[model samples]
Target: MCNRRRRVDLIEPSVVGTRNVLNACLKAKAKRVVVVSSIGAVIVNPNWPKDQAMDEECWSDRDSCKTTKNYYCLGKTIAESEAFEYAKRGELDIVTVCPSIVIGTMLQPTINSSSLLLLTMLKENFVDSMHVYHDSFTEVDDCEKLSSEKLQDLGWKYRPLEESIVDSVMNYEERGLLLKK
Candidate 1:
């Protein structure tokens, strides 16, 4: 899912892999399953009311995503949709958590896509060319703010945003991936 190089590459892992995981969960008789979706799946729709805050109810238009060539969003939407459909069969309880751009200290030696994005922004002249395919893929101008209200209601706690950024930067510096500035 992290690889945005090819649209074709996204289909197998996101859609098929998600279904396989759900099937395995059903077979295992798991009581509850949580699928980590992305905000990309929720807020990518242009049809959402401008003044209304997007919530779990909102779904990105799949056709719109395809027309715009936003494969990442398309993949996430399809995967999440399939997950809900599987859950609707009433075999197992399924919950989908859609998080916005996550930034935190790295647990592994290598950097991940989110951290890499933060790194690119932190460092000057990181890439030769940056092509933004569409505004919806990168930004959500209509919504007032991205909310964690749903997660908060579930008693999920997160570290402060400042702490996350600082920790990530420190981790990058310690790993010699980023020079101390």
Candidate 2:
């Protein structure tokens, strides 16, 4: 089950959940317990430029988290640390997937509500209408291009932002959605 919230103090619950799952896995003698995590777990605001790439050794700084910046990274760091601790304790086999800004087809209509909103906003130049942000954005197709092959070598694949947007738009159109313009 996915848990989403802004509470910085709620890391305890995640730790507890991991413990329970690890315990169950150990009791069951499971071979693996793959954990879905985020790249944010590592790579929190180091000296690296935005264009720089990060790898498994990277780790986000929870101490730098604030209401304005790094909160998500902080939570991810704490949760991932807990998972690592569990793994070190030899509770069960653990693997993790760390993707940035997951976007793509939703298995259920309820998921990825943000991608849908982004598509709706883009369909009519809503950003331009609001005069609230940058001028001229990357096309959806362009945004999803990433080092998928590189990540795949590590047993990971990211849904490019472009692919997610296009898929969302097509899905919406198939569902009878129409562009206002």
Which number leads on TM-score? 1
lDDT of 1 by residue, 1-181 (tens): 5445678787657888888999999889899999988887887888977677778888889989988888878999999999998778887799998877778778767776787788877665332212222222244565445567888898989987657766776777678777634
Compute each candidate's TM-score over C-alphas.
0.78, 0.60
Worst 10 residues of 2 by lDDT: 127-136
lDDT of each: 0.77, 0.60
Candidate 1's TM-score: 0.78
Say which candidate scores most in lDDT: 1
Estimate candidate 2's RMSD in Å. 7.1
* Candidate 1, lDDT over the whole model: 0.77
